[model samples]
Target: MPGFNSEVRKSLQKAFTALADHYGVPTERQHFVEGPPGKALADFAAHHRADVIVMGNAHRKGLGKWVGSTTEHVLNRVPCNIFAVMGAADQ
Candidate 1:
């Protein structure tokens, strides 16, 4: 699972790089976050003085619902606005 996640991240990085290059945007300002979703997101918002937090809502079954512990935690703790993108499965 970790290997798969790593590959997915690499693929995302590649896609983001291509998009950024196409737009003449520097990648230095882009932040790739990989950590416990809730705490890490909160910390990032606080440190960066961010006004919004964007995240994907993975449609997980059973135990995965509880895994939203991160989202819930962040929603409760963070002072910024939260935007959640629903997964295709969720739609």
Candidate 2:
């Protein structure tokens, strides 16, 4: 995190907060996690005993199925169900 951009981190946190607020979800539970995205999420879920994991899939078309993304990485790591929402182009 030595070179991490605080501005971008703040922007992403704001976005997450706004999105959660738009859906009437509490922003208090939102987190701007670091480390490997999938691992971070998986750890969070496990720590919180989350019943399900909802995540966006960002792997592009040409990327092989095994070519990793946060969604795929957490599939084998977490115990809960995963609901992946693919981006428009990914679909």
Candidate 3:
């Protein structure tokens, strides 16, 4: 299980690195955290006093609409700004 987790983490790191490069974000600014996405992200942002967080819409159905649990959770916990991008219309 630990090995599987490591492999998954490696894969995620690769993808994150590519995206960061594409966005012109430096490697020093990137952080790889463990634990639940919402809590981890919110805690990290809060601790670092992040100016803004850019995220993708979960596109949830019903009441949430485009907002998902993780995004909502982060929004509720974080004191920073968030820019949620809508997913593609076809998706």
lDDT of 2 at 17: 83
lDDT per residue (tens digit) for residues 1-91 in model 3: 2345777888988898898899998889877777788998999999999999888876567767656788889999998898888788516
lDDT of 2 at 16: 80
What TM-score does model 2 achieve against the real structure?
0.74
Worst 10 residues of 3 by lDDT: 1-10
The CA-based lDDT of model 2 is what?
A: 0.75
Candidate 1 per-residue lDDT over residues 1-91, each given as its tens digit: 2445877889977887887789887778666666766777888888998889877777877755434767788888878888877777876
Off by over 4 Å in 1: 1-25, 61-67
lDDT of 2 at 52: 98
- Decoy 1 TM-score against native: 0.61
Worst 10 residues of 2 by lDDT: 59-68
Each candidate's TM vs. the true structure?
0.61, 0.74, 0.79
TM-score of 3: 0.79
